[model samples]
Target: MLFILAAIVLTAHAASYGVDIAESISTSSIKCLRDLGFNSFFIFRAWRSLGSFDPNAKSINENALAAGFSAKHIDAYFYPCFSCGDPAGQVKSFWNQVTSKKLKFERLWFDIEGTWSSSKSSNRKFFESLTNEAAAIGIKSGIYASYYNWEDIVGLDYKFSRAGSWPIWYPHYDGKKTFSDFKSFGGWTSPYMKQYNGDMTACSHDVDYNYRP
Candidate 1:
């Protein structure tokens, strides 16, 4: 009986998985992840400041709260489309919206994959500025990108080592499902989050599976 009880307790405290969604997913899809035992979510908010914000962010947040799941916000404004106007302008616009709306997330993720910003120096400056803005508002920030993108955008050199200090969320779908499969890369000894699979399903809706360590 004691052994059986221990098994039950261990199962109750097992680590939970989560998913990342965007405008492509409806508010109703939030339930899909919850039903799959996901305890957290990261919903895409915007591609750029000038681009449209996700119309379903609030609904997803509300639904996640109702389902007893934590929901966070994500944005792809780091290297926005070149045609989206000035990068600095978009950063300011994004920061303004983030402050004015009172998005109650403890942390935010900045997507760092795009061809608009070519120079390494420009990209590094943009990242520093984004981190500063988030710090001013008392919100922690993380970088979300694949290992390839990390090496390509920031490199593994001493100068780019600054990125490893921040929280790293690496996405790699290499058919290795275990968290142990995610090894350190690009100067980061350990990643905060690892997107191990991109073909996960919940309630018939497709979502990416992420492991939070």
Candidate 2:
């Protein structure tokens, strides 16, 4: 029992414990994880791009609250398409959804992949405006991308290039780069450099790591 307790403690700090995932997540699983001391979770396919939107966010929060999670215990966000629309439309849509949602959340995550930002000036303008939009309504926002992606697709040193808004630290196990420890991953691709991502549906008993970018 003592060993088990120690192991749990050790694993808890390694990453955000969005470890194991299931086909469909249940309240019991979420509750059990919270009881185990996990305060964060990643929601899989938590979007409504096409058909009707799922009430998963609110429902999950409901269950989590029943299990003992306050608003402080949960953080939720989604995968956003950087090139979804023109700059203005993108910012409008992002905040529109956030403002519409009544669900209690801590942060908004924007995943920038496969899209090209026009220029540093344009990127900074849009990003800063987006951050200001979220903050104006009392919400926190973040961006997910690796250093390589930033340098290649998106230019670094934008006005909003700081780590808090756009943390660049990534996960690498090949021993080539030794900055970030492996953490929660959102997709199936291995070697993710994120502290927490929504890879699966259910929580797990495994360990996860967290770090700054």
Candidate 3:
């Protein structure tokens, strides 16, 4: 019984930590993060805001994998530029760049913060186009947004059909490393992961600390 209890505690702790990175870092830096208890890594696959792919994405992902992080625990995220238009094209570009480099990731997370168009309908359509394109390519997708950002960009009352089923990664930046403060938004009653801290350096690498529980 004691052994079982200890195993349960270990499992729970292992499932609760992650980090997302935009900058390129060495494999040793990734191993450092792993040593600090971050088991999951989310790397930026695209930067639509800059109208280009993240040049460092593949390298960061490769470093994480080299550090012994499983592909299943490493994922990709796309920062969409609402004004860039051609949402479908953006998705295709993201998919192409990631595949071209053979980066390993389990899912694609759509970063849904920042400025949006004045028209909510247009914003919703843009989002739908992105997800639709991702679905057509057979890649699973998720969303990363906070309640305020969702409300500002997509409206508080707006809910997508797949929002409930799609995994959500929300940010709070309270430095708590837990999901106690998450509020339902965009049809997500709970979050699959929480970004509890932002713009911090750990092990000589810049990262946003995240947790999944």
Candidate 4:
């Protein structure tokens, strides 16, 4: 039946589609996105650039839950301040904020695209400390970056030891929901998630579309 086939297609589409949100969205808008077949949501937990927490982190997470998203369907991301000394300390501050606000997430994604220090060693140390500290706190972590960004920030030759184990969420704004273009970098031969689109609106909310395949 055509109806049955459509349902199957929608289910498959939902399984691969997700969105990462930075702005605060209402519960109604969250529900709208869910109804539109977005299966997962990644929310910003903190903004390390300003050394401050995202004021809407708690509300947006609570709203997502209220809209029927579970812990497994939601995750948090942090944008680190590259020049912020003591990367471990920054992670501590991030965790503290998460606990203080009681925000629940399945994993923490490190947003790795931005200005960097002149020293590649310093940059590598910053990323290493971030993941190491996340492990210390018993929370899983992943990287959100493109091959170009990764190579620029950490250098292509320097492969991270834990890259094989840690999942990677990369970005390629080609508007296609597949990972056909992912180039191996940072020791990751493949990606766990691909952000195929960025800076777009759906359900009247600003979101970057992502896919997991």
Candidate 5:
């Protein structure tokens, strides 16, 4: 079974996103955001290890799913900032936990927050290979990063992160956040939600590319 299932060991992706504040929110707090059009935000924080990161989010994924959002919208950011083991092993563990028979997700999010010098290169290659594996399984793969990281660490000339046609979930918070992907990941909290849930939108983007026609 392990050999036949070597794909996950190859690269399927696994990263965490935000902290664990969503768990403390009012039972209805999460719904309020979803109710107020904040339906797609993740709160899965990751831990970067030696040469890879492990992402096995259970609490967050379950909470979001119970709240009524589709599994696709309920995503996590996997940060492999310090991975050293077979990226394949870590990736496999994540997939098994994430896509268990009970909960089926259509896509997984790959976050590259950057950790060490070598990590930058390792993360780049990992994501590239993950994009291919995800496609084979009929799932979407993506990389999350800030504008500064994009232009600086990832380099302006590199094209593979965005090349697999995987959508980019860029997190930017000034006043409002936007994206060409139509879907977003930030700025949904306000004075009211703050009191009720104390959780804020880590990032948000416009996946539709709406132009107000």
Candidate 6:
């Protein structure tokens, strides 16, 4: 039937598309993002390095809730910026924010970078603790890192263990390329998401475009 064929066509076109934004990107709004071809969003809930929370996350969560966005349509994550005064305490603070504000997300991602880790052992330990904390709270977690960051900070021979099992949202950008160009980074093979464009202008707002495959 023509109706059944049309349903299949729309189903194939319903692949997930998302964008990641932080408080620093002041122009970004949930309404504009959704209107500009993005069906899902990954908003920063907290930044550990600053030893504080991002107030924007709460607003975005509220906006998404009011807009009737489902959990499958949004993701909230915490970013632990470089070597802070207390890594363990930073993780705890992020946990507290989620509970107090009642934020909900299907998955969390750890923003890993080269400048964050002091040494391989310390870097490994940070992820180990983050993984444990995520497990306790009943949330799936992943790593957001480029291959260069993983090798530069964590060492090429480093064994990630529990954290290694976490999905990777690889960032290997080459402007205006197909998602098939997304390559494996660090120790992860077959990344869960590909950030294809970092400096993309969508709805007149700068956003990092991502594809969920």
Clashes found in each candidate (C-alpha, N, C closer than 3 A): 0, 6, 0, 0, 25, 1
Question: What would the per-residue lDDT of candidate 4 be over residues 60-127, giving only the tens digit for each residue?
Answer: 88888888888787888888887767778888988898898898878888899889887889898888
Better of 4 and 5 by lDDT: 4
Tens-place lDDT per residue, model 2, 1-213, is 999999988875665443222124567876766665455553332333322234555566556556665666454544444445344455455456545775665555544445557675555565555555555655565555555555554454332433444333243334232243443222212343344433322254333333222
lDDT tens digits, residue span 115-204, model 1: 536676666666565556656655566677666775677664524334555677778886454556555665666777777778666666
Candidate 3, 1-213: lDDT as tens digits? 999999999887776687888877899988888888886564545555765789888888888788998888788888987778898998888788878889888888999988888888889899899888988898888998889988888799899788866799998889886778889888888789988889899988789988876
Displacement of the residue 186 alpha carbon in candidate 1, Å: 4.6
Q: Which one wins by lDDT: 2 or 6?
A: 6
Model 5 clash tally?
25
Number of clashes found in candidate 1: 0
Which pairs of residues collide in model 2? 14-208, 14-209, 15-208, 15-209, 22-202, 171-193
Q: Give the lDDT ranking, best first.
A: 3, 4, 6, 1, 2, 5
The CA-based lDDT of model 5 is what? 0.44
Model 1 TM? 0.75
Per-prediction TM-score: 0.75, 0.56, 0.91, 0.91, 0.57, 0.81
What are the Cα lDDT values of the candidates?
Answer: 0.59, 0.47, 0.83, 0.82, 0.44, 0.68
lDDT of 5 by residue, 28-95 (tens): 55565555445544344332343332333455456566777566655554555334544555566555
Q: List the residue pairs that clash in candidate 1.
A: none
lDDT of 6: 0.68
Superposed model 3: Cα runs more than 4 Å off: 1-14
Worst 10 residues of 6 by lDDT: 22-31
